[model samples]
Target chain A: MSPELARFLQDCEQDFQQALPALCQPPGSDCPAVPGGLAEAGAYSLGNGGKRIRPVLCHAAAAALGAADRTRSAAPAHALELIHTYSLIHDDLPAMDDDDLRRGQPSLHRAYDEATAILVGDGLQARAFEVIAGSDVLDAAQKVAMIGVLARASGMQGMVGGQYIDIHATGTDMDLAALQAMHQLKTGALIRAALALGGIAAGASEAQLRALDDYGRHIGLAFQVVDDILDVDGDPSALGKTGGKDAAANKPTYVKLLGLDGARQEAQQLLQAALTALETFGASADRLRELARYIVERDR
Target chain B: MSPELARFLQDCEQDFQQALPALCQPPGSDCPAVPGGLAEAGAYSLGNGGKRIRPVLCHAAAAALGAADRTRSAAPAHALELIHTYSLIHDDLPAMDDDDLRRGQPSLHRAYDEATAILVGDGLQARAFEVIAGSDVLDAAQKVAMIGVLARASGMQGMVGGQYIDIHATGTDMDLAALQAMHQLKTGALIRAALALGGIAAGASEAQLRALDDYGRHIGLAFQVVDDILDVDGDPSALGKTGGKDAAANKPTYVKLLGLDGARQEAQQLLQAALTALETFGASADRLRELARYIVERDR
Candidate 1:
């Protein structure tokens, strides 16, 4: 992990914290067309939450490749954030995850009607494309490729598929392989896509994009393994939301399939594989290397 | 319609009908990793039924504008079809309109499950972008703009927003103006967008695009008005499904808001307005003019 890279990511975090509002909040915060109380309903949750890791991954990937075209990466980055946040909204819906809290605040569906939550998710998903497709970056080929990447990652083959699988798994018995497959689609694919899009915008060679995708896949799976373990052991207060909901719901988890200790070992193996892929890039991957470690570590 | 234009659309319809199985019956349709069946499910209403009028409109828009760029419009045309089909799926959902049949076949959700229908809608929406963004026919900027147009028309400020208002209006005493506003967003916006995308792909001037959009908006509203009128007087067998459901649900409609006779008058007026917008386009809009008349006069 490079100190400069870590500091750069921190700065991006600060910048993202600032840029997200205009990208997300209604064209005007007070616009009545957005529905009464939804402004607060939307703003309260999206305004001050999330790890912002997806955007960070985009920035780091572009920066590492010496790509200076901010325009190319801007929309993709925003698209990533939008997709991630929108997923949170839907996952929190009563018919979905039904979690009452997110980032230590009342979830959007909880603070607002179930309809509003569904609508917000719909809006955010559309806006994600508007940001990327509307951005002045990349050639037609790259832009088209970018949309394909994001769409597939977020669509049936990826996040939505994962959610669909998880939704169907409620109170069902599942083994470790099935649980891993579920998380791979739900969480891992989109995260991998974030890195892939950065490479796409940067004009990385197919081989390089493939390598980064491999890295993203490993790290994304590792990230979820850590999440599952944290559910069994980490403090909920620090997580800013309830943990153990998976267990309470009889939802399967890596820790449930594997013992608590076994889950940690598996996460380490994924983190190692992720690091191995980054080794192909040597010093160019210093940030990604750190990102992998960050996934398996930290209290969040 | 110009015989040439009609032939072209008819050709596309023939091609799509043949490929429909490949498109609808994904290879891993039975994969449990996906929450819903991405493959064709019960009733197969979407691919086999409907006029496929929206896709025809997209192709017509591109062809009439002299695109010479057949490849570029493929993604956008397919995207338009997906969005149109997804709207039908959601509109027929139990939580929405609760229609059991569409185009003489069982609705997607009713034939499946509520959650499957929701997931299908989400998948279609996601896949639409994948097709558009991945298309090689347009530049990044063009693709981006097209995406923005689709998003605005489909998301909260557009189709979904209009849906919320419509659902909210159920059993409520709403006026004609309010009803018009709702339908404009729900139905007309997407039609306008489809024309705009087609024109944009052909490098249409802002004025040309605007005129096409204006024509689309007018005819779209007219189409809905005629639909409501048909519900009142249409033969159930010809309708190919249940009629009078909207009235049975006590939902607002053009006929409900305006008198039944008035709805017909409005449809005629709107059709003329649509044709009038084409006066600026010379001979290129001959097919569009014919289509507007068809929209107002169609029985199903």
Candidate 2:
């Protein structure tokens, strides 16, 4: 990555790390914390620390859009991360993917009980929108639009729907189209929202917003494709999750359908397409372009 | 109930029945229904007829505020009902209350699998905010504010947190203060939001809004107190679910702390408090007044 891109990613990550704890607390002054396991469960999962790719993408989009008050974009960025973390918590439930490990530790359900995990996910999801709606940075309209976009992406039509399809399709033979469709909703929608939220926060023109969405869609797919590839070839320690579970569970994946080399080629093509979508923004989109390359290349 | 209040409730119920189906479908034309059991699970619980108390409360508040556009309050009312339904679905999960029935029908997790029930609850919660944020009737600021209020009420300082406390306090002795705190968060928050959302929808003044909130709080506590009394004395058929489950689960409740007659006396006192809060509104709040009485008097 370029030095500038690297520095920008670091800054966004730091901002998220600092802002997230306070944001996840109960809104009222009377309540210091959520009454029981809620705060601990939420804090555990959220603090586990992934790459914060979603938030970085949001901040990158803000920069790319020439948003004057870039710090204001933090609200949407925080909201996206909260949504992502909550999805992970739910996905790791015994009734769902039943994963034991995440980010080098036990998944939320395993770390806590299934009930606490469930409430934590629900709390996080609620907090996501609450934070965005309450943000002073964005105007009311932008916040409303952001809420609609995020909710639609995270709800039945997006991540949750995709997860439903995924869980049902396990151990079944699935075609590429089916796999792509699931990934598009499950992961792609939030990623696309990350950029769209940034653009919305910045008051980007409709056309510019569309281009950012296009760029986001391409990279979103690429990120998932790479994830499938990594699952087959990744080191468990580095990945901070158990690898080969996909194959063991007989889940359909890009590597399984397209083969490793073919999947790599697909990711490369998506990387190019993502870049192409960002062409109109010229130098302003440099960080986004770098981030696209990073999505396909990241090991964790 | 007065004739006017009865008619208003019937209209809200009819409107809800008509609107909920379309509301559950995917927002965009690009996607059809969620692949499989997702839609069915959500529909099963949401379609099952509850008293629609939250929606009625919202509508009554709107009417009390003299909001000329009664139709405008539909979005928030619907949103509140969705949140309430989703909470019931989650609370019925095997790890939680482990209920087999809800509103005289099979509980969501019992009717479907646990996984589907979990996803359905998540979907409904997400859809609530989406519906509000996307509503064209309210301006953006109102939408944002409504989302914030609903999210905070439904989330970690509110319903979810209260559930956490209740579940943990099961089979344990607790005093009146702890019991009230739990009930206030578990049930009162959403009830409060229902009235608050309605008031906000009508562009109520700060004093009017605070009065609505006060009325809502008194009735919210009354509703729970009556519920505990019902659990001890209600007919299963009349209540539409088994009674005595709260005692059976060893859950903390008003009856456990106050005894049957004492709980009833508390409900009556709360009803009076609720009525007192609306005194200044005079006949404009007649429906709300009737509703407050109904809350304490209702057999179901």
Compute the interface RMSD for candidate 2. 1.5
Regions of candidate 1 where Cα sits further than 4 Å from its true position: A1-14, A24-41, A67-72, A137-139, A171-176, A280-284, B1-10, B19-21, B24-36, B42-45, B67-72, B136-142, B172-176, B247-250, B282-284
If scored against the real structure, what TM-score would every candidate get? 0.88, 0.98
Q: RMSD for each model, in Å, please?
A: 3.7, 1.4
**CA shift of B190, model 1, Å:** 0.5
Residue B103, candidate 2: Cα error in Å is 1.3
What is the per-residue lDDT of model 1 for residues B1-300, given as tens digits with 9 covering 90 to 100? 457657776787775566442443333552223343654641254565577767667766776687663565767777777777777876776556778888877778667766666666676778788767756667766777788788778876677777777776788887877777887887877888889888878788888887888889898889889889989878899889778878898988888878888898999999889988888776666767777777788888
Span of ten consecutive residues with least summed lDDT in model 2 chain B: B27-36
Residues B188-237 of candidate 2: C-alpha lDDT, one tens digit per residue: 99999999999989888999989999999999999999999999999888
lDDT of 1 at A172: 98
**lDDT by residue for model 2 over A109-196, one digit each (tens)?**
7888888888888889999999998887689988999999999989988888988898889999999998999999889989999999
Candidate 2 segments exceeding 4 Å error: A27-33, B30-33
Fnat: each model in turn:
0.52, 0.76
